[model samples]
Target: MAVLVVGGSGFLGRELVGQSLAAGHQVAATCLTQPPDLVGPAWHALDVRDRRQVADLVTAIEPDVVINAAYRKADWSSTADGAAHVALAAASAGARLVHVSSDAVFSGAAVRYDETSVPDPIAPYGAAKAAAETAVTAICPDAVIARTSLIIGDGGSVHEQRVRALATGRMSGVLFTDEVRCPVHVADLAAALLELASSDHAGIHHVAGADAVSRHELGTLIARRDGLDAAALPSGRRAGTDLPGPLDVRLDCTATRQRLRTELRGARQFLGH
Candidate 1:
């Protein structure tokens, strides 16, 4: 299938592009700044927020699938500008739309959220993403919305920095042991997304790591894996408050697994543990 990846230059987008290319699919990616060297796809200088440009590009490519992974903020957003444009463009081009969403849309109060959870976003970014989810589904009924959680990998993430700080004895604060999260590695997430692109699973789907761990535990594990001092880092509960969102952010991936025909694994395996 010919696929167009909007915001194909970001961290997750890079992984998606690489995975799609490796799967022997025709890919076209767009970037705002530096477009990376995509092996199996042509890179285009496209901006998703600009309606005319997005429309022109989509119409020209006439892609069978359009994966919208572009977002202004990784965590929060108050405006739905980027999301709206992508949805509108996808509808205009008559392509199957796949919108990347987040588990942040949920308040994280539920122990495990399915695709049916009503979004109660506490942050601006979460609110905007939720809005995008509604708009995309309404505009394009065939659109696929994948809501994922904290992304983990070796390629520069918030968790990686924290691990580095403690390993190098540069830690200044305690890790949050109370804040639990299910972090999916970018590579695994990409693989699942590719599987979804070829399936008929339309509507919202939650994607996250199989195992959920507290912030402190995750940090400790990373330290242990790298042969660093796990005891050197402080507990993440210095503030004595659960994270603003759900304490246990595990997702029910039954639908995702059924469609992909494979179970998604947790983030710990990325360290080869």
Candidate 2:
């Protein structure tokens, strides 16, 4: 199958492009700036915000599947317009669209959220992602929406910075033990997405690690794994309960396991524990 991956320069996007190409599929990817080391697929400089450009690219690639992995940088705004534009373009080309979303769409109140769970995003980022999900599904009912959580990999964005801070003993004390999340590996997530794209399944799906870990626990795990300090530095406003609303977002991947017939790597296992 031929596939088009948007935002192929990002952490997860890089892995998806590599994996798809390795799986004997024709892959075409797009990125804003120069992408990381990519060899197998055709890389095109694409700005998803430009609807015409996105549509033209997809139409030219004529891919059997289109994966919308691009996202706007987290800022004060709370909407994912670029990602939605990719979905719109994919739908215009009549290609199967796969929209990557976040577990943050939920309010994080539920102990376990399934595909059927309604989105109640508290943060602007989550709200924007939720809006993007709605747009993709409403436009193309056949499009697959995969809601995942914290993605773990080497030298990405969030995880890498945290590790660096710990190594330098510059890690602040503002840690949130209240925030619980399931972190999935980039490779595993790409595999599951490929399976879903190859199949005829539609609607929303939750793909995540097998277990949930609190923010403090996650930080400590990464610190210990990398042989760094795991002690509290100093408590700040961000350290207390008044910190950004912590969500206990643990996704239930029953449908994903049963339908795709694949096993997801647990957070501890993925983190090299």
Candidate 3:
């Protein structure tokens, strides 16, 4: 299978590219700002927000699968609009699309969410993700929307780095005791996504960790894993914050487990006891 991974320079995108190459698939990856550190896959400088560029690239590659992992932190045009462009381009080229979405699409009103849950995004980022999902599905009905949670692992994940910084007194912030999420390991998510590239599974699929934990617990676990003092990490609640975000966006991965052979490990298992 020839796979084209958008945003291949990102944390998750990098892993997907590497795993795809290892699986003996012909891989081509795109980068916007940062260049991918790993070798083996063909790399291209691409900005998914550019519709013509996206269409031209997809037409030229004509890959069997196109994985849309491109995202900009809070940029709607790049994150949401870019996803639409990629999906449309892939669909036009008759390529299978696997769009990576987030649990943030939910407003955290529900304790647990599944693939059937409706999107109720609260933040701008979450809204962008929700928009992306909608556009991808509308443009390409056959596209697979893999909605995952906080990605954490050994590859210097941002979540772990923040916890380490707080534990070491380099950063002063409280880990939320109220905000709960199912944080999946990067390697596990990457493997599942790569496998899904060839799958005919359409619609939204929750591909997340098995365990749902509070932010404080996740931070403490990451601190302990990095040999930092877990007690040093402060905890707080997001309920009374000025700009409060989602409280609990836990995704149930029962569908993912039944569909894919890849095992999505929980953060506790990845970080150890």
Name the best candidate (by TM-score). 3
Measured over all alpha carbons after superposition, the RMSD of each candidate to the real structure, in angstroms, is 2.5, 2.4, 1.0
TM-score per prediction, in order, is: 0.89, 0.90, 0.98
**Candidate 1, residue 229: how far the Cα is off, in Å:** 2.4
lDDT of 1: 0.78
TM-score of 1: 0.89
lDDT of each: 0.78, 0.79, 0.91
How well is each residue in 1-273 modelled by candidate 1, as lDDT tens digits? 898888888788888888888878889998988887656678898766677887888889989899988887643331266777778888887888888998778766676888888888876677888899988888888888999888777746677777769767787777788777788887878888877878887998877888787878788777877778888878756234643444555678776776676467776666556
Q: What's the C-alpha lDDT at position 243 in model 1?
A: 37
Clashing pairs in 1: 76-125, 77-125, 108-246, 175-236, 176-236
Residue 248's lDDT in candidate 1: 58
TM-score, candidate number 2: 0.90
Ordering by lDDT: 3, 2, 1
1 or 2, which is superior by lDDT? Answer: 2
